[model samples]
Target: MEKSTHEPTADEKYEVSSSLEKGTNADNGDTRFIKSPEERKLVKKINWVFMPLVIMILFVQFIDKSTLTVSALFGIYEDTGITHDEFGWLGSLFYIGYLAIQLPNQYLLQRVPISKYLGVILMIWGVTLGCHALGRNFAELAGLRFLLGFWEGCTYPAIFLLISTLYRRSEQVIWFGTMFATNAAAICIGSIIAYGIGHMDGHLNIRAWKWAMIIFGIVTFFLGFPFYLFLADKPKSRWFRLTPEEEKIVDERTRDNAVVQNREIKRDHILEALKEPRLYCFFFCSLFLNLQNGAISTFASQIINRMGFSSLTSVILNIPYGASIVLFVAIATVLSHRFQEIGIIAIISCILPLLGAILLLVLPLGPVQLLGLYLSTTSPAYTLLQTYISSNVGGYTKKIFYTSANIVAFCLGNFVGPIMMVGHTAPRYTPAMIGFIVADFLTALMFLYVRWSQNKENNRRKHLEEKGLISPPPPNRELLDLTDKEDLSYRYRL
Candidate 1:
């Protein structure tokens, strides 16, 4: 394929300058930093500082979310005196608000500058979580958790925007996968915090579980500012202590990556995004994948409790689950980079969870069986699916929509997962496993549909070109090869 030296038309260049002057509150300077090909390649490589910031924020976010699960060992469940089913509701309610905020959050990322917007969100969630220390009933706790979800929803889409803007399609899966391993770290760290605090139930005449929430909230609040100061709003807006060359490299590399197909966000383009079929199919797949994700987030602690271990040991033993997830993510990232076959990687990941659920349902209750459940449930499907979304959806508007839709699926799954842990199924958790099995099969089917549809589109393009109905396909780095652009018959991952 001919290399794209596709500079914007004069009108487009003028529009970008006009936007910079009006939006950034600065006189127009040399704002648009283009680069030579060598500089562009160097910059396109990852920025070390930003990658760590992304990992840190993601780690903190996951720890805060998963810490509640670890709290089960400290008598939080008993203090609340909620039924098994109600416990599920308490767990799932966060996502109800989480889903509600997805679209608004994505919109804000596009409109409000990221530094102010994302930093404010982090502080809001941190303070709201601290309010949990005062919760006296299920209703009060639920409200705080919901608000936390609402404020925290901004982070996911924003992170997606940052990474999608920084890294190219091939580099994303590794960083995304590594960032995802924070889920495992969160689980391990949450358990460690809970284990230490679980002993303080009578020390301060307060419940250990309440202490768990209080401690984590304070830490998250403190970490927010440093993270905010360090995060790059976008490659073009980066203002850290980097040398001029580093800045130039980042700007050039990020632009060449298919990610920045359009810099100007418009209302008409936003509406046009809603029409892509890939957006919808990916939504369903994400929903099912996240259902399992949400279920595990809510109940993995309880599942471990059945393994004849103390809450502390249950928490500690569960470290392997997260560790396994880290391993799976790393493996998947390598495969995606080497083979570029998102479909096969996704299929294998989904199957692991399906097998894990089956083992939980049929095998005798024992350590081995329980280990299987943990291994299967914690597979890397969720992050890999997200990689597929980021890699394929190139249009800025469509990326926003897809990102929001994925979070919505996450919310739905989180909402449904806990509810399935019926009161009758407590300890046995038979019903929850059954729900997981069904969700896994549906997720697999969606991936299959995504693969088949993309292949069909590719064939159609080939046929049309053979008949001289359309231009011949270029060598693989064309927009068609990148597969992220709209209007290219690039099928969305179901």
Candidate 2:
């Protein structure tokens, strides 16, 4: 909200931009003046070309994550001779692998071509998933699970940070929403696909679970090719075939988005991120929001079966559960983006899970309680939180560090959740629900504070500017590669 004394010069623009990507080359397209109409067409082309492939990659990723959850009902437990306790540990192991990779990923994402890296990883990831079929014991399966998590961990943040480079802050809301919505579709459709695969259990003498893993793995392996071949690596990538004018538009966008593409690690940015309250808030919000998600995803079939539904019936019921999440994500993202009341929307979304948690505690183990279980897993808060950090965080190093921390928080919540659902509790995880209630409440308060803190800063900056104590920020101040803390003219998006 504060202003800078100077508008950005060409040198400063390059300083900030050098971090995001190499600018358009002369031979590729005419990198000159662009009209508004041409810019719209380019963006629309990007939406069509980019978003669907992203959805496919993400869809496969989500389905792969839930493979363990679905395999449980298809004879994996008995086939592997694993007990319930070991099953829970497998969940944690995956996240442990995920958490381990975050720091390394921060560096790799900047240095490597993210699309190609992710592609090869998915191809490898699919092979890892299929290998689950060969596990005859807990140790083998555990190792496989860890590897799966390790590869999968490289995805979400990479996609998110890439989006920051591709679109303006305003354009990102819908894309982020679309990306989160993929999980719901994956769950709904994957469950149906799993049910169909269950019938294949005896055909090849390969149990239904093994077939499920192998089949999905093959599909995932092939999906990587498109990414390697077609996904744009930078604003000026030849893949997009932007006219020179459109490339110019992207340059303008680069300044506005303020995301640096440079690979250099800045110590000051890291220190600034460590000192900021938003970093912790992003971490804790994701951690708490995902706690219930981890538990439910791991145990959905068992919980529904205990409610007296058959395993097939339990899988079928997930259709509705997944469908509901799509709605929740849609409503939350649309409303928050439309009204610019993201914090309030986030606070409200958190309340759904809290109420759902309360219902799980008070209601008996049956259909009603099952409804509570579904309610307890609201999906919108996570999306909003992710968007907030992606839109607001500046500086390549700081954003990488910040995004890695958020992923780490996500891993921690998920890692602890399954273990917390102790076998002694059996059907109803009363204690876990109580813990979830607390986490959800804290999530709400954190969002509220983030909004208030940012708004207060906005007001402080506004007052100073009005008094002429500070000049207006340079039109392209973001091009300086400044962290949010270092940028005096920066305003936090609500």
Candidate 3:
């Protein structure tokens, strides 16, 4: 298939209509959607300006949320004299706040413009992060953590909406992969930042961890001020960059704002979203995948410390996971784009960590065990799986529903993940590892099932066409039109 460098043109109604059953198919072997050289140059410019700004915003959000996990290793538990069990409460408390306001967050993302709403949300979370310096006890820490969660919940749903609006289905996979990979960078950078500043424990008579938290928080808070100036709410809204030709193509490809418009959530919209089987499959599968991911993210520093590595060494060791994530995300994104087969890559990603989980559960604490833990952290398969879903699912209401459900499941999974680390399972952490292994296996099975169900649905639709019960023509040639219609060429591929 030839890739189009520009969107449909005004006089070229053929480009827009060709994907429908009633029109000629542009994607037939004899025809291709290749753009003119001038059009390709314009697309390159727009993508360059926008992709980095979006990725940077996501990176800061992850760094702020994840720093606490690393801080637990050298700062809080070391200085405040808290036990590991008490530390678990601190780690898991954020999720309580996360789940409390997911639906509200989605509403804000949908109703308010991204320029104002998301900018406000980012500033609030940054302030919450800075306030960690005020928490002197468990109760204070828990309260602050909840507030942080409340603000942080806005990031993912807002990003989903931005992505659904900004990019075509084929282009969103890499951007989402980059977004998730930033968390791995947080895992690495947070530890290094913590290790460097941790020695400031008695500086000005404040705890080192508290200072680390306050500094990063203040930095993130101030960073939001700039995003307000640079980030475009949608492709049509780009004020500083983009040629008129580039804007026209993007507008047409995205249906000229009709498909990407900000919408108000309604009761029936929620009900309509709840009826899809793919929604449940995505929720349950992602729930398990992130359960394991949360475990790795929240407790990795502690696990490294317990393996007899010094604080500096522990931080240094974390670099591998972050490095691996960068490589894997790039590889996965390219493979998904080239093959147009996200499901196969997703399945392979799930299996890697499952093996790693088993190794962590059964092996003795040593270099081999540490390697297992590091390898376990490299799964971006679920990241790709989710990108596929987010980029493909049509209609604003259903997209929001699936996005919110995914976040809710993520919070729920993280909540349960820490609880599994009961007092008896501490230190060695045999049960927590075993639990992750089970979650991985189940997630893998569900992904396979969804893939099978999608194939079956496609086959059934084809059979109906033969019997004249369904339309004879396929709309795959006109992918843009597929975004709005509920029938004919529209079908969720899970």
Candidate 4:
């Protein structure tokens, strides 16, 4: 039989409609609807199925991205004979593609099946990473890195969008924290794996760095199959096979979220998002934080090595760095959960890294400096930045545009970060240290603006509330896909 050619309608493609059916109350905006025993069970199943898949994808994909860092540990420089200048270019090229593609990605996000899109890109980048082992010169390596980065660009926004659509704001914080914490897991695991692979040098006449790339590539490619087969692409999913009653719960959750998932790319949403100061605040905050991240993550192994440890020993030392990431991210997550404050948590996250940069600058190189290095930067702020977007932004088009701009900041910071590793700053990397201090400080400042802006709006909305409860959403606002700006009743999350 010929394949069915029918395209699913908007109602069919977007499974969770805001307008409710039997037993599901449309007006229950702030209150959760999963009160029944069966409904609770369904919620658990949703969490169970989605969490591991998202986390594992994060773990492997991160390792794949950091393959260049890991390869540096195992003599990629000597093997390829690329100069420091070329090396910086190699690092920048990936993010260049990453930034280059996001404009198109903004549209494709609304047009495509994100799960399948992410899965396909995962496999493609896997192959690209594997091919990195074959690169003998700067040009080859640069091309492959660009391709890998170009494909990997889809990951964050797609995952961010997925989490926002799949769960309500209350549940989103956990997933966001867990998803980013997986970066630390990947670092630690990749470090351990690299430590072992480092020992395998000359086995089959293959260098350890090559082996690292090959192994990471194979694992990444295989991971795509499961994600494509199982991940829920939309709010209503074939994977969930949710019953009508269960579907109602999902719909209610989506209605409460107020960020409708549909194929339509409304021009006004994009225009509205562009005008919002908070949008620039989100992207620039990310750019500044990642400036430190891009520089530090690329050169972390080198920094440890310069502190008088062996290459393999530096690989071991990264475990502690990974530990620091987990600890800080955990604290940020818990505080956000406890206090429901985004601004303060973001500021706190930057302060650690600011201090870390200062320590790296002032103190003599040793364990203290290493401790500073670990504390100097972690991803709690970046994680919270993503959470801020998902929670606060409402229109589908605006959210994607906000997410895309954030990705651009991510790419730009990372692009310039590796360039800071120029040889003149050896022994101390003093310039990079100063760069971190300045960038992280800026990030903290921007988030302050974010919090103040949000607070002002949230406070204004309080007057609209009825007897201390949040005001009911304007009629059919959820179905209309109104932006937070358009919907006066939609409160800005802290």
User: Cα RMSD to native, each candidate?
Assistant: 8.8, 7.7, 5.3, 7.5
Any runs in candidate 3 off by more than 4 Å, and if so which?
Answer: 1-39, 78-81, 240-244, 255-259, 266-269, 462-485, 491-494
Worst 10 residues of 4 by lDDT: 24-33
Alpha carbon lDDT of residue 178, candidate 4?
89
The residue pairs in collision within model 4 are: 353-376, 356-376
Candidates in order, TM-scores: namely: 0.83, 0.91, 0.87, 0.91
- Cα deviation at 303, candidate 4, in Å, is 0.6
How high a TM-score does candidate 3 get? Answer: 0.87
Residue 177's C-alpha lDDT in candidate 4?
88
lDDT of residue 33 for candidate 3: 31
Better of 1 and 2 by lDDT: 2
| Candidate 2, 1-494: lDDT as tens digits | 97778988655654443343333212111122223565678888887777778899899998988888878889998998998878988988899988878888888998999888988988999999999989999999999999999999999889888888888776677778888889988989999999898788888689998998899999999998988888876776777788656666677777667786887888898888888898899899999988888888888777777788888888888888888788889998899767655678889999888988798778887877777867766578888888888778878788888888999999999999898889988767779988999999999999989988887776676667568877665766655788766665556777
Winner on TM-score (2 vs 3): 2
lDDT of each: 0.68, 0.82, 0.69, 0.82
Which stretches of candidate 2 lie above 4 Å from their native place? 1-35, 471-478
Model 2: worst 10 consecutive residues (lDDT sum): 24-33
Instruction: Write model 4 residue lDDT over 32-91, tens digit each, in one string.
Output: 333556456677878887778888888987888887887887878998998766877787
Cα lDDT tens digits for candidate 3, 206-226: 877788788888887777776
lDDT of 3 at 239: 52
